[model samples]
Target: EAGVAQSPRYKIIEKRQSVAFWCNPISGHATLYWYQQILGQGPKLLIQFQNNGVVDDSQLPKDRFSAERLKGVDSTLKIQPAKLEDSAVYLCASSLDRIDEQFFGPGTRLTVL
Candidate 1:
């Protein structure tokens, strides 16, 4: 009955600093996703999780970015040695199934200096 939840709605860091974002998906949802929206650009999928397993992460920069959906309910995304270009809104969404329309949470805005 609850919508998704995210913490620390905003974050500020210098380049090379590390940051982590958290997400709690809606109940009964089976698929979860993380996305990054850079200024002026549409959100790009960063990772997809079906339950506790990874479904897709081809576009994610594994060298600096990583994510996990622990126990198939809540998730976390992290960036190490972050770059200025990493500044963006990090969005979390969930759906009943992979093909279902997703419900999104208010994103976490990260500002890298």
Candidate 2:
């Protein structure tokens, strides 16, 4: 089975600039998630989608962060007008179900200058 895939592995942007990351989950997976992992900290759930509908996005920062999973397949995360504190690893993960084990992508590391 194909594993989760992410791109641009790393990024550097000035504070207040927008940045985006992409992800592709495993085939046939029904659940997708985006997480933010700051240095020296565990990953924090940012958003979750079951198929094409959002299951949870309570942790997402509505003022600056947004995400979407279209066609219930690939997904994208965008941080607009980025902040210096937003520097961290943006991880994309997928699971067969909400309670199942998740497979994670390599993640995109974003740095704000």
Candidate 3:
């Protein structure tokens, strides 16, 4: 495939609500990542997964955000009790390995009231 895949291209929720986004990586890829991109700011890595294991989540808000990549292919990211600050684009990216370049999916735009 040419790139990664993501679902529910857009979502709108009020503060204190919850939302989930999904992603599917290119075949043969082994690394997946989730990023949050706020308007006027660069995308920030939220989580990284290698196969079915977690690699990094240091920048993720543990109290509100959760993510998992199952079977090393599909991934999901969730946010609970969303806040206004959570309004941003959720991007999914995948690569063959940590050192390889990544191919990103069209992002999921989230609007939190």
Per-model lDDT:
0.96, 0.96, 0.94
Question: What tens digits encode model 2's per-residue C-alpha lDDT throughout 4-111?
Answer: 999989999999999999999999889999999999999999999999999999999999998998899999999998999999999999999889999999999999
Return the TM-score for each candidate structure: 0.97, 0.97, 0.97
- Cα lDDT tens digits, model 3, 64-105, are 999988788999999998999999999999999988998999
* Candidate 1 residue-wise lDDT, 1-113, digit = tens: 89989987999999999999999999989999999999999999999999999999999999999999889999999999999999999999999999999999999999999
Please give the lDDT score for candidate 2. 0.96
Best by lDDT: 1
Candidates sorted by TM-score, best first: 1, 2, 3
Candidate 2 has which clashing residue pairs, if any?
none
- Residue 112 Cα positional deviation in candidate 2, in Å, after optimal superposition: 0.5
Query: Measured by TM-score, how close is model 3 to the native structure?
Result: 0.97
